[model samples]
Target: MKQNVWLYIGEKIIMFVLSIFILSLIVFYMARLAPGDPLVSYYGDRAEKMSTEEKARTMERLGLDQPIYKQYGIWFKNALQGEFGLSYKYKEDVIQVINKRAENTIWLGGVSFLLIFLFALVLGSFCALRENTILDQIICKLGTISSCIPPFWMALLLILIFSVNLGFFPSSGAYDIGKANSFKSRVSHLILPLTVMVVSHVWYYAYMIRNKCLEEIRQDYILLAKAKGLYVHEIMWKYCLKNIMPTYISAMAISVPHILGGTYIIEMVFSYPGLGTLSFESAKYHDYNLLMILCLITGIIVISCNTLGQIINERIDPRIQVSEVSRYGK
Candidate 1:
């Protein structure tokens, strides 16, 4: 058992490292190969005015004159030493640029994440408990429609309704300028984006939960519990809901990237200052260093969350762990 545990940890570590490495290679090569003047991002209008000789000297100074492979090698070395290089667009260290905006993304994404799962669990269980009822059907239909709508479109519609028409919420940004520390200002600004985030994703997960709960309700143990005179609500709350928690947790972990992507899209539409907006600007301007770090950060989060979900699933269901061990002959 100990050996299996260690083996599992080792495998996950290797997989995580290899995934990041491959991701780095892909982003590095693709960004360099993409058509753009990265120098323009760094030097602005001055880049276009520079003579060929001056441009060559500038490229050499920035090490862009090197072959792609050599540039990657140098980047990988510096990355190992925690130097991710400067953002060509921001004219600052990539980490520093990210740090300034990371908080907004984290707040938006984290709040939405928690709300999504929280509401998913409640709505899912509610629908499961009242399956085939009028309320359940209505919820199902509404959820399906909402989930089908594109997040960006939903964001715009919400902004139009709540921000433009009613004048109830701020349409863009994480907070009023200079109100970063003000909670009320933050929440007010968050309303439109959060509404879009929640509306767009809540039902999908809720539907999954509803199905899982219904499946649990039909199980032999549930039948036996029903025979023992347990109420439907009692059985659902105590058994069906409990049984599906591990699966729900796994789904939450897997949905990080999905939710993160949505958050990014919403940020862009709303002019929110977050990694998503930064990512767009970096890619648009061909800020290679900034784009690379953003991609790496996103990739790491996605891969780590997926791995964590798998580990949690295996832990909760020992049969899965045993099967993995046997499959690997560990």
Candidate 2:
């Protein structure tokens, strides 16, 4: 047990380091191709009129005049010591800005994700159990239709319906200016975007869980339990649901990454104080430091979730081997 724990920790460290290295390489390589000199992208039209000496001085300041790979080597070395250079827009240590925004994004994600998970599980079960009935057909259609809509467009529709037409919630933003720090105020502010969050996630989770539950219900064990005089509800709740919970968990693991990614759109539309909004603004302004950081974070979330999902899958279904022998050979 101790050895397995140690191995798991070591594996996690290696995964984290590998993720950082690959992301750093991609970011550095992409930064090198920012259309023009770093100094030039920052300066715009002023870049064209600069003297060769002036350009050389500016390039030297950004370390842009050096060979691309050499510059990346230095950057990576400094990054190991916790330096991400500087932000082009904020003109501050990029780490501080990233840390703050990361917290906000994480908070929003946690709340929204939890709410969506519970909501999806319940609603999905309802729809799935009612399969072939009119209610099921209607909800199934709705889920399919809702899943097709882009998250951003859905945000807009939500704003129009709830804030403009209904006048029940704030149009955009996360909190009231006066009571920004109050929990009550934050909850009120959260309702609109959270509504969007639920809308975006529910359909997919419901459909996946519903299908998984349905499949489990048809299994031999479930049939045997039913034959042993178990109530339909008992078979569903105790037998089928518990049996398929691992798959439900895997589906959730798949969905969390998507939840993080979805915030990029919903957060932007509402101008919510979250990391997704930060990413959107950075991309628009060509703020490569911020953009790359957020993108890397996004990738980390995705990879970590999938890896953890595999671990959970292994735990629940030991027979479901992860690796398989290749059928094709020379």
Candidate 3:
């Protein structure tokens, strides 16, 4: 068992390394392929008028004169050593730029994730318990509609309703500029964006969980539990929930990274000072180093969460054979 666990972990580590390498290569190439020069973001209109010699000197300074493979090699080596290069646009270390914004993103994402799960759990379970009832049908329709609506559009509608019409909630910005340092002011500013995030995500998860619950509830084991005279709530909570946990964990793991990434749009809509906002600005200004770091961070988050979720699922359900999973993947 210990040997299998170690082998599973070793496989995951190998996969992680390979995924990072491939993702880093793609990020490097995509940044280069994108239109606009980093020098333009650095020096603005002056870049267009610079002489060939000046351009060459500037490129040399930024190491842009190096061959593409050489540049990637240097970047990969530096990244391995915890040295993400400087941000040309920010005039700061890549880490510093990311750190300044990461906390706000974490807070926003964390709150949104918690709300999504909590709400999904309650609504999903209730709908499943009341399956085929009017309430279940209503919730199902609502989930369908919510899934169809784009998140950005929902964000706009929320801003229009709550911030504009209702005279509540700030439409944009992390906090009022004058009271920016106050925790209360920041929390007030977060309400609209947080609501937008939660509303946009909750229904789909709820619907999915509801269906999973309904399916599990109809299983033979659940029927057997009911025959044994177990309480409905006990059967749902203990048997049904446990059986569907792998699915729940898998979904959460897959979705968390997306939630983190989705903050780019949400933060942009609200002008919140988070990783998403930072990412938008970085891409807009052609800040390759900053963008690269963001991509790397996102890749790590997704891969780490997925691996962790799989490990937890395997531990919880010993029936899941790592060797079988590996063979299936092959």
What clash pairs does model 2 have?
none
- 1-330 per-residue lDDT for model 1 (tens digits): 687668777988999999999999999999999998988999999999999999999899899999999999999999999999998888999999999999999999999999999999999999999999999999999999999999888888888888899998989988998999999999998988999999999999999999999999889999999899999999999999999988998999999999999999999999999999999999999999999999999999999999989888888888997799786676
Best first by lDDT, ranked: 1, 3, 2
Task: Name the better of 1 and 2 by TM-score.
Answer: 1
Q: Candidate 1: where is the Cα deviation over 4 Å?
A: 317-319, 328-330
Predictions: Cα RMSD each: 1.4, 4.0, 2.9
| Candidates in descending TM-score order | 1, 3, 2
lDDT digits (tens) for residues 1-330 of candidate 3: 567567767888999999988998998988887888889877888999999999999999998888878899998899889999999887999999898888888888998998998898888988999999998899889887886788888888988998899978888877788885789988888898887788778888998898899999989988998999999889889888888878887788878777886777898887788888888888888888999999889889988998887767666665776555575453
**lDDT at 68, model 3:** 79
The global Cα lDDT (0 to 1) of model 3 is: 0.85
Where is model 1 poorest over a 10-residue stretch in terms of lDDT?
321-330
lDDT of each: 0.94, 0.76, 0.85
Estimate the TM-score for candidate 2: 0.85
TM-score of each: 0.96, 0.85, 0.90
Where in model 2 is the C-alpha error above 4 Å? 1-16, 36-55, 322-330
Better of 1 and 3 by TM-score: 1
